[model samples]
Target: MSRASARNVLLVEDDTAIATVIIAALEDEGFKIEHCTSVAARDGWLRGHAFDVMLTDVMLEDGDGLASLDSVRKAAPDMPVIVLSAQNTLDTAVRASDSDAFEYFPKPFDLDELVQAVQQACGGSGSSANLPDEPDDDGMPLVGRSQAMQSVYRMITRVLRNDLTVLVTGESGTGKELVAEAIHQLGSRRSGPFVAVNTAAIPADLIESELFGHEKGAFTGAVAQAIGKFEQANGGTLFLDEIGDMPAEAQTRLLRALQSGRIRRVGGRQEIAVDVRIVAATNRDLVPMISAGTFREDLYYRLNVVPIELPPLRDRREDIDVLCQHFLSQAVEEGLPRRQLSADALEKLRGRNWRGNVRELRNVVYRLALMARDDVIDPGSLADIIGDEQLPIGQSGDVRTSGIGQALETWLAAENPSAGSVYSQAIAAFEKPLIEHALGRTSGNQLRAAKLLGINRNTLRKRIGELGIEPDRFARPL
Candidate 1:
């Protein structure tokens, strides 16, 4: 029979409503639609007759849609299988593509486009060659298969369903703010604004004004009535980053805001009722700070209502390959040439102690894309960009020497003669360049730079003073 005259399609969908809608749409296009809700029925129907194309949901009551795809491909190798799923992510997209599926449609997709994709898979004149590409608007979501990240995803989904306060704790480069943004996106308040404030980045005197806003005459620089993050994020999410670095006064006021759901301007007495979900993040161990009396224990409990901990990248090395591919795809979407990592380069990445975690990996990949001359990224190219001295011992043949201890010893012997004073200078030298490098990377955005360096902005400021590095030097020119 001719191709157009014999277009038979099998659609496996668990939702009866969705199946009815899709079947009506496909049937209208002059193709026969055979519907099945379970894999057993789908297999039975496949055995009875040949199908030109197959459409299956990723999840069903009996089995996964990919399994159905496998069965169809085995029985009819030429038949095209399209996967429909609500769980839209890079990892899922890649999996579908690698499985030789013809296309993928994320949920809430346009019916017209899906029909067209089906047509194309069946070799129709107006059919698309591949599934509609995943949207490239946002940068890639955090991709991982490791248990650590899986747990993190689960906790984020659970916390996003409510307005309870959240505290995200992790090492500096572990993408704490990304977790907060994910929570906001997945929550009921997705349409609401997501306002973020870095407590440590603001000056101690100005923190109050920054968090609670200020009246026109609040202070010398307060020329107009300013709105704070709390007010701006009203009815949404307010992410307080580096909460541990907040000044005692600011901490007290923040506690009041969390407790009362209200705020008063710096120079105004009226307490304005506000509704905002609070998500706080910190690299510091709050338990220690609470014991030391620097952090309020009550505030800790309030913010820790739903605690989410992000494991450092080193702890989840299994995710490095997936993350690398995800980032490479991101770079390509951003107008850079697409590239793949060589096996050696990928192995090196897996072996490294990722102190900076995901953030550092992103930077490394971006740098490699810019510096690599060829389409494939080799180990040498990656090493050159991330610096060879930072490579793991087994790969580089160099003894592991990049640590605070080694830095301290070098500084003590070279710069300080008196043992008593050596400790201070050693600490300064070890910290100064790291802060400077992070500042340079972020163009002196103290908040982001502080997160990258794994130090509180207040501590960064103190070190800036001790190192005699002017903050203005690192500031970007407007």
Candidate 2:
């Protein structure tokens, strides 16, 4: 370890206690510490001296420390800046990343993490450039509270300020486009347009011309010069969805563009420089594609610089209730009648296999809002809406498609709750959907349901009252 006198650390923190603790910790680790209470003092110190690293708190007594990031970059481009802030939301994290912070610590952070970051910085020569100032925070559309989702959020936040290519992998309808849009909207390139191209959706022959543009008379149908997605997305983000399907010729050109930061129009000689960020998404496994000679392994490495793997909806079932509510609100905004899901209805939704992930869930919510007879959606209405969407089972013969037993097993595994009420809970789960389904089919006529269910009408009414089943909702319209 170097002597404390040989290395200097500039710390800008308004809180006296935090500053003292941080200063003491760095000094013990053989680092010389220079403390500033506000951005004003930091600016004054920036003129005459340089430091090994900088530790800054976003909020300060005089002005925000984050706003002074440009000054630090200007004064010493190679000095790494670690941000500390009490504002621990995603917005703050993204902003810290946008400013090209070496590391960011929320207030009440682990001191050991900070120490390790500083030690790493001290041993290395920092060369990454400062990121341009980013736009105001635009909330991301990603909806989930599971640990899996949290990891995705962290990765997104880390890449917001950089031009690094990101490869998002997940099943279809897992909102890969949503992830791409969020990164573009929240990053320095928000002022630029976001262009998206689905590689799989386009024909094989036209993929290159579609992405790299074409000059007049380039091909048989080239009557005029046309801008490609690469040129159109210059200074912004280009989302290449389903990249695993990109043709070999286009993949070769894409690799060239990525390497040279330039694109050449079809049938034209000039190399046009473009300042675009690429975000690619695919459901197919690229490793297998590479092995099969479908996807280029070299190109895959270039695009997979930062990989964000989104967990399927089934893996994050804890988010289903919130997602349903979010979709319900979106429906109301779009002139649909307001609708709320009953507890049992939400439970039913949580229990299903979301083969289509968030997209399928949104469709079900919209259908329930449109077709359900009442404002409060019950388990029966949801079941009916979702049942209509059951996709044909594939070769895997997934057990989730078999019945509600799969859903209950998943819920039971997650809960591992007391076994005493397991029988009752299981019975209620089956009974509510069945009884309400019968009531809906019979136009809410108890006698008809009793006959259909092979039970006494009095007994049917008793079960209806016990389950809080609103039979009126299932009555046929006049």
The numbered model that scores best in TM-score is 2
Off by over 4 Å in 1: 1-140, 391-478
TM-score per model over all chains:
0.60, 0.62
In model 2, the clashing pairs are none
Per-residue lDDT, model 1, residue 410, is 41
Model 2 weakest 10-residue run by lDDT:
388-397
Model 1, position 7, has a per-residue lDDT of: 80
Looking at model 1, report the run of 10 residues with the lowest lDDT sum. 126-135
| Reference-based lDDT, residue 460, model 1 | 78
Tens-digit lDDT string for candidate 1 (404-447): 43334444556537766667754443455467667767887888
Please give the distance, in angstroms, between residue 65's alpha carbon in candidate 1 and its true position after superposition: 6.8
Q: Which clashing pairs does model 1 show?
A: 120-127
- Against the reference, the lDDT scores of all candidates come to 0.76, 0.81
Residue-wise C-alpha lDDT for candidate 2, range 49-150, written one tens digit per residue: 889998999999888788767777888888888888876556676677767788877777677778878887777866355566666564456776565775
